[model samples]
Target: MAENIREHLRRLLSVPPGKGKPVFLFWLYFFLVITSYYLIKPVRDGLFLEHLGSGMLPWFYLLNTGLGLLVVCLYNQVRRRIRAVPFIQTIGCALILVFFGFRFLFGTFPALAASLFHSWASVYNLVVVLMFWSFADDFFSLDEGKRFFGFIGTGGVLGGVVGGWLAGLLAEILGSANLLIVSSGVLFLGLVVVQILGMAVPSRRGKGLADDQEGEQLGSGFGFASLYRSPYLRLIAVVVTLTMLCTTLLNLQFNRGVELAGFNGDELTSFFGSFYAWMNASALGLQVLVVGPVNRRFGPLPGLAVLPLICFGVFADGLFAASFSVLVLGYGAALSVLYSLNQSSRELLFIPLGIEEKYRAKAFIDVVFFRLGDSLAALAQLLLVSTALFGAAVLQVLGILVSLGWLITLRVLQRQTS
Candidate 1:
């Protein structure tokens, strides 16, 4: 009966029959961790934009990148010292403690508290999600990742939907400060889910990469220097950086729209939550219906090109008229498609590499380089919004140019792989 059920799900979700149990567990784990993050995400965004003020966003992104560097360094050190499961559990617990502290501080000095929480949340999102996917890369072969990552990602998107909805519903009742307390609980639940996955799934080292089976840990490699040495890695870096840059651009626009829309406090929280809920729902649908088939049928190059093509249209439209509704739809669609297909295709690029390259190089690329793009985009956004440097019209032009570059780079990346 279990085998029969697995076969049915294989047809439905496109997971291989042999991969059914572990993939399902991985999906559940992603759901828990993402739900935990999304629960606090609205609170973080509202507090940051409202209390810290939008003008300070560049500084926050810079701080996030700096902290990302530290986090990755410490993460590498910790991974060396402990097993993956225990390391993850310890980090999750520490993050919960930090959230508890944020809960207390937010009540006392909201502005300062929001700044701190915003920075922490920025780093937390990248670190936790990257770590999860790093483990995921270990679990699946290159072919398996192409086949099943979309289905696994669907779980995270659905979790985002639920978390966003719950946060919106509860924001007024519990208040933003107390939302931190709830997030702490949700994070703890994520750790418990990790424990469940650990018991059910075999260690990647035991069944994963051939090099990894020799039991050599990460950190022996040159890390960021490795990216410098390889043209292929350089292009991958550009693709990731550009993708994140566009995301940063959209985020600033979306937040500005929300602020202009005149929502504040719990209303702001609820609004942002609803916006995320809608975005994630779109993403979930795309991941379920389009991502896997697109990857398999059209290949990763087309998957890579999809966002730039969409953005070209969105931002080109932005050159003439800009409004709250336009920002909502345009930015949300860009985010949905990027996170759905583009993101899965991006990770697929790493699957063909060695474990060290897969993990260490990945940590740097995913965390540091990605955040570096974020920081630069934030700085650009700051200059535009604050100085009115050439105004929003010029920013839209810049986005169009960037999208073209993104398209060109996709071709370069495809050639390198070919």
Candidate 2:
């Protein structure tokens, strides 16, 4: 069994690229990544709210943030250490399969499917982000990235929508906990099949010139300092940090909005799951229509700057809607659409960066910076709630004002990158 597994991985790593097959494989794999996330996140957030309440949401986010940092920080070092593995993607595939397999065969023994799912979901979030973006960087050069990232990103949106709806529908039928386990088992089975027979990406198409080197140079124990040197990287970090604060608030509001309706447990899980699906659906439309065209026509800075402005609207409207169910839904809807635009456009920004900055530096920003922002916002949320310093409206006000400053920073960053 071990030898066959090794052989399967060997084949997956060595397959040659001809037409668009390599890119297609990337889409297929990343689609599964997002699907896994969508399946788990709604339930994770809903479960956290049900068990721990709004106070705990910040902590749960902090947990995710920490996990991302740990994985990304170890990534290069890990690959280098595993000299025998040769192909790290195979190791990832094996890990994915083994975990899922354990849940399936032993799910009845203890630690129900939902328990295993949560554990795996925690791991999956960081792994997928690192893998997919690394693959994206591998396949698309700086010049081509601008043209293709929007379209490629759609795979994630579609996967999110599918995963959310599936989890919700499954919850309605089998219960959230049960369905979560089933999703895990099913995901594992799918991965096993793919690992065994999935076409290998041709070696040449899958690696950058410097990809094989894993050392202290890029992002070792410390993250990429060169990213800090790039004007664009600084602005990207600032803008994303601001955006993270807004999203953190929005995420809390979402939980609170449901609580305002008086919900918890499985019912809350189902509703939030459905709500997430709807948001992804809305985001997909904006990605297709607004994100790419706007960037191509207006240039990268405006493409990038538009997000902070959208975040301003998101915060303003969400505050008003915080008290009203109808308004809250609209607020959620607007954020969904705007976030997609922000997401697609942000991926576009990676094209202009240097090589080390794109993979290592960006990974740091995604994990460390993102988590730092979330942690800060979460702490702020607690402090404000405890001290009664301000209501939702005040937080909204702060978010909008800071976003304006972020927009100015983004303009400067884009100019430096250009």
Candidate 3:
């Protein structure tokens, strides 16, 4: 009976024989990476609110954009020199050290630490996730990606559920600052998983050009030149930008609501932790029940369309309702789709590109462009709020407009890819 159940699970995920070990390793690797980030996410936000307040979030967003560009540039340089596995391992080690360093600094300079940690957390999550998918793109063939990426992505969703729950429980017991140590340990475990994964999938490396050849292919353009050169990439950039714009607007509104509700310190941390836990729990359901079947049946284009349509409805409703519950439902639903269907679909789009473009261009789009959209949204928020020129209803309208733009761009991209 147990063996029969295993066979049924394999058939459901469409896992090819002899591919189980590598797929499971990749899944575990993603699980560890996301788990570590979720642990830090709530702590990062709560500490930022406690020390810096929500008003400063926009400046930090701008700071994150700059830092994200620098990191991607550095990442491109390093990636050109090393194999994918070593590059990921090196990043994992560096992140572990950074977390430990922050843990120490929090003792003496917490406000400053909180300020810096916010930007670090933002950049850190983006970089690690980009690296994982870039590596995955290298590892899996296009046909295999269509078959397996959704299942692989389910690992991250499950990780988010577990990590968020642990975060809520741990924040109460360990206090928010000490949660950094716990995250550091989780990252260290992630590094170990990376090592094991590297060994288990040794043959998958070097599918791209050799180190020197890849560097030359990447050229002096770094990543921007690729974006300039490719219409498909440009469309993706626009989609990402509009998506992040809507996301940032929704997040700011949610944070405002949370702030006004009068929670502080660990209570605030616990609240965010629970929020993420529930949100990711919803995401897990979508990943299991929605993403795979939708992608397999209609292909990724339809899956890609889901988030914008949902956002459009949610924001359109928000314009009428304009309540905390509306913000909660809207943001939660947006994120649930974003993390599940949207993520799997977006990563599938990269499978057709060349290795140089996969690593360099993708890093730019995911990190730099992702943060560019975020910063622009943050700047817009700051201006509107500071000037009192627009109301929350106006922001809702903007979100609705952005969602429509996202849908239109996705339509164009779908046509191009088709």
Every candidate's CA RMSD: 3.8, 7.0, 3.6
Best-to-worst ranking by TM-score: 1, 3, 2
Which has the greatest TM-score?
A: 1
Per residue, candidate 3 scores C-alpha lDDT tens digits across 355-397 of 7787678866876677778887888878877468876577778
Model 3: how far residue 166 lies from native, Å: 0.8
Q: Write the per-residue lDDT of candidate 2 for residues 313-337, one digit (tens) a residue.
A: 6677766654455445655664675
* Alpha-carbon shift of residue 57 in model 2 (angstroms): 1.3
Give model 1's TM-score versus the native structure.
0.85
What candidate 1 gets wrong by more than 4 Å, as runs, is 1-7, 10-23, 130-150, 197-226, 348-363, 383-385, 414-418
Whole-model lDDT, candidate 3?
A: 0.82
TM-score of each: 0.85, 0.77, 0.84
At residue 184, candidate 3 shows an lDDT of 78
lDDT of 1 by residue, 331-379 (tens): 8888888878888788789878887687678766876667777887888
C-alpha lDDT values of all predictions? 0.79, 0.63, 0.82
Off by over 4 Å in 2: 1-17, 81-120, 132-152, 196-215, 220-224, 318-323, 330-339, 350-353, 356-360, 387-393, 411-418
> By summed lDDT, which 10 consecutive residues of candidate 1 come out lowest?
211-220
